[model samples]
Target: MTRAPAPGHGGMASTRTHSAEKKRNSVTKAPTRLWGGRFEGGPSDALARLSVSVQFDWRLAPYDLMGSRAHARVLNRAGLLTDDELERMIGALDDLEAACRSGEFRPAVADEDVHTALERGLLERLGALGGKLRAGRSRNDQVATDLRLYLRDHARQIVSRLVELETALIAQAEHNLGVAAPGMTHLQHAQPVLFSHQLLAHVQPLTRDIDRLRDWDKRAAISPLGSGALAGSSLPLDPQATAAELGFDAAAPNSMDAVADRDFVAEFLFAAALIGVHLSRLGEEVCLWASQEFRWIEMDDTYATGSSIMPQKKNPDVAELARGKAGRLIGHLVGLLTTLKGLPLTYNRDLQEDKEGAFDAVETLLLVLPAMSGLIATMRVNTERLETSAPDGFALATDLAELLVRRGVAFRDAHEVVGHLVVWCQVNDKDFDDLTDDELAKVSPHLTPDVREVLNVQGALASRKAYGGTAPDRVREQIAALRAQVNDHASWAADSEA
Candidate 1:
């Protein structure tokens, strides 16, 4: 029964502390390497167990392999590697990467992160030749480079999915252009609006989200591979050549800045959080519109579910999941921000906590955006329900004031008169159009029965003839603009990877 050390035991302790422990789980190594040369003994097994990130960071192997291959090519061309040695090193790296991707390679428990795991794999695969690949880099720069590569690729994917979601939104809007619904303020009817106009409002913000992700990609394009530790490597390596080969737009100019700038990570998650808010807003509407009380839209069977106990229940599980997903996306952003708030220096083990958050945000957006898009595209808008509800409340009251303003009445006097009329209608258990002509004229003798002409929901929506209004023409104009924006994005998305 050997007891655990108090707080700071400093020997090469046993590795049995971790429950799922395996021999290959820690960053196993040659003890006398450059990083460990100053130390007499190794990290205690307890420390190793706590410090290892191989369990999750092994996801980075492919990126690690790519950076290592690029570095090896640069070193050999700079006359560092012998011709035969370079060939053996490059061949082994390529093979190791292929094995990792093909699932034949397994990272051992002794490996700490993907960088260490890959190096271990390389050393075993090519013996002495593999040792030469680490000549001009550190895990600091290497891990940062790998993360940048991973982010660029993932951001591009998220942007494309956002575009797809925008397209679905536009499709739904166009399909329901003539549809009218009660636009609400604080969840109560405020005005009659084209259903398509409501849909367009949702589309534009998500479109901005796509642009935000694209903007993030441009910033994330700098390469971090030459910034070894917190200083530039002394090796006469061409950072540009490696950047170009690896598809980075430029080499990171400063070593410390390269490793310290986790801003991109936080930026991405923040953008994801904004997009998640958009999805949540969209989901809230879907959940509401699909409700038996509103019935503005019906969820198609594929995107809805049933209640086991209630035989007639058709639950909107998809939208509910979108609502739930938004919380995760937002949590990811907050989690990463908290992780980065007070960190010091070029790299710390604290930085390793960064991966789980980013991985979750990316995965959530990729999944949530598409599912939400499909839900929108397949939904059925019950136009009659919307129209009936749109007119039931005095939703056209604003249209009445606009009509009065158009009729040579002072706008201030018209607002007063309109408010009185609404209160009258509400008290009498009637609607705006249900008012008698004499009642309106009592408030303002200049008013006539013709005022009721502006009181219907369609009249209310159609009367908003300003640019970007809920008028049918404005809705069509917006649909055209949305379509154009989506087409441009589609083309850019198609050519992005190329």
Candidate 2:
């Protein structure tokens, strides 16, 4: 049996040696680093191999291909590449992309990074003409440019998935309409609320996460391609031309800031962390709602797992995993922040550390967001259990006071009367509804047959007909408004593309 090759070194040729071989065979017989003129000799084989990023960055093929085309046109416009050379490079880039997409482009293990692999591919495809495309650009600028494009694309996909998750939550809320549940504060039941209201609370934060991604794209719109190698290029290049071709609103103003800025990366992490927080909030509720004591929700067998030791146990593995993954999302943010913090201006080896953090965050959220949506969509709400738990906390005791006010009892006095009656029921092992008229009258001779009016939980919930209340009428109105907001958010995302 053949042994697998070790990481960092595949067989005898180091990652750097492979890079040099690629450069050696490349259109430039000199095998030049885009910025190697300042150096006396090529990087050490071990150092080159150690610094390689082609493995993960191959994911940037599309962005690299697109950006190369954009840069080629920009160079042609600047009178540097000539129109014929530009056409050749563009055609070669397209063919190279097709090769990558079709799995025919064999990546070199020593190919320093994605920028290097891309240049190597272009050279192999276009012969000597590919050399002209890199006349003024460095991998420093190229990598940064590719990353921005990749993130912009990834953010759109994740936010769309997030919107889908929000839609599922909204649908669940609608399906469980009028299902009464106890709303809690400090883990103790505080009031009666529609179960939909609680689910909608989780939806609102995730929706904000989608909005955050859409907003951050605006900041990422500037292209960094022309900020070659930290200092502005001396080639008299037109940054705006490339920026326009690439769909950037403008060229980044400062060269050093352009290569050094992983702020866009950090912003994506910021957005991902917020999504993590929202998922954690939803996960916590899922865990609680699925508990034996609560028993307000049931996880589908497909989404849940049975305990190994306990034969009858059905656990919410999906929510538990989501809650667990939320920690990883936070760790990605902190790791990226710490990695980028205190780094010097312009490009550094440390910026290479940026990819894993963001890539992990995006990968985790992409999986968890969609899985959570499916879990919520398929799970059943135990409406009877929700209603049964609703009346335990004397959730309608406040309604009794509201009833007194309608009867012309001063609110302050009515509040005292309800408080006394609640204590009376508690001391006697009775629910607020279990108290008889004689018992209610003992607390208040003013309490009439109308005291029976406050005993019904449905009547109590219905009386709360104020705007945004959990009353059936109010909930329906809220549903309409929430649906409208979802449509408005969708429209805003569409307008951004316009």
In model 2, what is the error at residue 30, expressed in angstroms?
9.6
- List the candidate 2 regions with Cα displacement exceeding 4 Å: 1-33, 404-415, 445-448, 488-498
Lowest lDDT block of 10, candidate 2 = 1-10
Q: Which candidate number maximizes TM-score?
A: 1
Task: Write the residue-wise lDDT of candidate 1 on 1-498 in tens digits.
Answer: 011111111112334335324333433535213356677787899987897776666666767777887898899888889788888888888788776765445555555666766777787778777778887788888888877877777676777888888988888888888888889899998888888899999998977887787788788888988888888878889888998888889999988989888998899889988988888888988999998889888888998899989989998887888888888888888887888889888788788888878877877888887888889889999988887787666777778888888988988998888888888777888766567878888767756888878877777777788988889998899889888888877676666655
Write candidate 2's Cα lDDT for 1-498 as tens digits.
011111221122333455556654654454435557788888888887787777777677677778788888878877888878887888888777776665555456546666776777786777688788877787788888878887876686686677678788899989998888888889888778888888888877876787788789889988888888888787878898888777778999998898999999999998998888888888888988899988888998888889889999998888889889888888888898898888877788899888877878888888898889899988899999999888777878788888888889999999999898888888999987667778878888877766787677678678778876778888777777777777766665555434
In candidate 2, which residue pairs clash? 15-110
CA error at residue 464 for candidate 1, angstroms? 1.6
Alpha-carbon local distance difference test for all models: 0.79, 0.79
TM-score of each: 0.91, 0.88
Give the poorly placed runs of model 1, Cα more than 4 Å off: 1-34
